[model samples]
Target: MAEGRLQRELNRRNPFETPEQEAVLNLLRTGDLILNRFGRLFGEHNITDSQYNVLKILRDEGQPMPSLGIAGRMVQVVPAITGLIDRLEAKELVVRRRCVQDRRVVYVEITPLGTKLLAELDQPVLALHKQMVGKLSQPEVKQLSRLLEKAREVFSQ
Candidate 1:
């Protein structure tokens, strides 16, 4: 069999040290490529991927969430959440409020403006998802997702 597309694309004359190494590298590369495309889309809307993710989390929760809870769900470091919230607050996309019961706790909520922006993005985001994996048959996509989930199970052990 010929070298994989990634090996060829990287111009690597030597084979990967192991199948595990190759699989990990492929996963990272694919993730990076997809993220880059998403970044471009978000850029056009004047937000970063992190910001979009934060908003999405809040929207999905259907209620104000603690700042730490939102940060825990994001790929970003906990400290970085402050800056992200700051930027979102500046845009009036999100607002931060002190938890009435606990002054030390801050809650973040998506504003009407943020919800509106997310609504505007719904169609484009869906289109991009289709564009990304539309070639895969539904079953194939399901299989891929299952396989990835199974692979992640190792981390739980």
Candidate 2:
């Protein structure tokens, strides 16, 4: 008898085919919205989401990493790690070095500039995350994370 929040938001004339369909749609919609917020924030600093992710991964590792390794760690699978690295290289944020023993392997290392940029963004990024889920209680946040992780397991199959 009652319309769901998502249904109303979507301005749907009909109900979702099933609860599963509704839940998945809601998750996707929410994820896109949250991602857009981060995109704006990243744009303010002239960085794309993928670039930020790459820098963060390299910074966290505390050393140079293989280009493929960086690609694997990316949240979304980026098809052209080379182009991404090239841009960062042009920005002088990161450097690509050929391996000494294995000439075929190119390693990417974050420069001081990249480290500084990430440090500058750390607080803003954290604040944005908090702002997005500010309405949720601590327990609710934990529950939501668990539920998301559980849903993600579907990918393993």
Candidate 3:
């Protein structure tokens, strides 16, 4: 039998123990490759991807949103969300507002600066996504999405 792409890349002396193991490794490798590309791009803009995501969620809401509410939409943990907000606040891209009646509830709103930053990033981000997926045909892209979604379903079980 011919060696597979991953076996050649890993320079493995033996085949993967199972097809599931091979698939998992491939997914992880691909995720790391894609993440590195985006990390560099976001770093150039002086913002991490996590920070950018916070701004995007705020901007999309078009109003102040409770901090926890924003965090719910993100992959970040609740505690980490507070840190993300703090950094953004330091950058003057967002402001934290305490609810008038509920001191414990903090709301995060994107500042004009935040909105501007996102606007500036819109084209470059889109271009990067296109460049990343450029090799895949439309149908291939759809298939890949479906496969990823199906993989995610496994976690729900």
Candidate 4:
């Protein structure tokens, strides 16, 4: 049957690869699937994942932050932050204020409208998290979180 043939092809692998390589490939594949699901959820709210992240960071800081500061917190380049802020400003979700003391510095702040939007998203966001990993017991969740943090420690060097 076609299904059987397809399964056989999928299971086929290079004989030269070691177990570590296969494990890493599997991890990448799983991460992609998880991120894709979150992307679709964020898209339904008329904002990309990156835009949501920017709004969240502003909310967390509870004050306008310099453009460079936001970029530094994120893994994005300084130039890309300008365009991102531009789009958010155009949406009226955020506003930009130039530093009076230093004209070269710009601060970005989330608007009241942005806060309301994020509030509305709160329930759905929690629901999505529950859908993703709610089945795990509390201990399992803690263990998984620890493992993920440890994995990131590898790159801290």
Candidate 2 lDDT for residue 137: 99
Cα RMSD to the true fold for all candidates: 1.1, 1.3, 1.2, 4.2
Instruction: Give the better candidate number (1 or 4) by lDDT.
Output: 1
lDDT of residue 9 for candidate 1: 82
Clashes of 1: 0
Tens-digit lDDT string for candidate 1 (58-132): 999999999899988876778999999999999999999999999999999999999999999899988998887
Off by over 4 Å in 4: 1-16
TM-score of each: 0.95, 0.94, 0.94, 0.84
Quality of model 2 by C-alpha lDDT: 0.93
Name the runs in model 3 displaced over 4 angstroms: none
Residue-wise C-alpha lDDT for candidate 3, range 1-157, written one tens digit per residue: 6777999998999998888998999889988888889999999999998998898898889999998899899887799998899999999999998999999999898998999999999999999888888999999989999999988997899
lDDT of 3 at 16: 88
Cα deviation at 110, candidate 1, in Å, is: 0.9
Instruction: Using TM-score as the measure, name the better of candidate 2 and candidate 4.
Output: 2
| Pairs clashing within candidate 3 | none
- Tens digit of per-residue lDDT, candidate 2, span 96-149: 999999998999999999999999999999999999999999999999999999
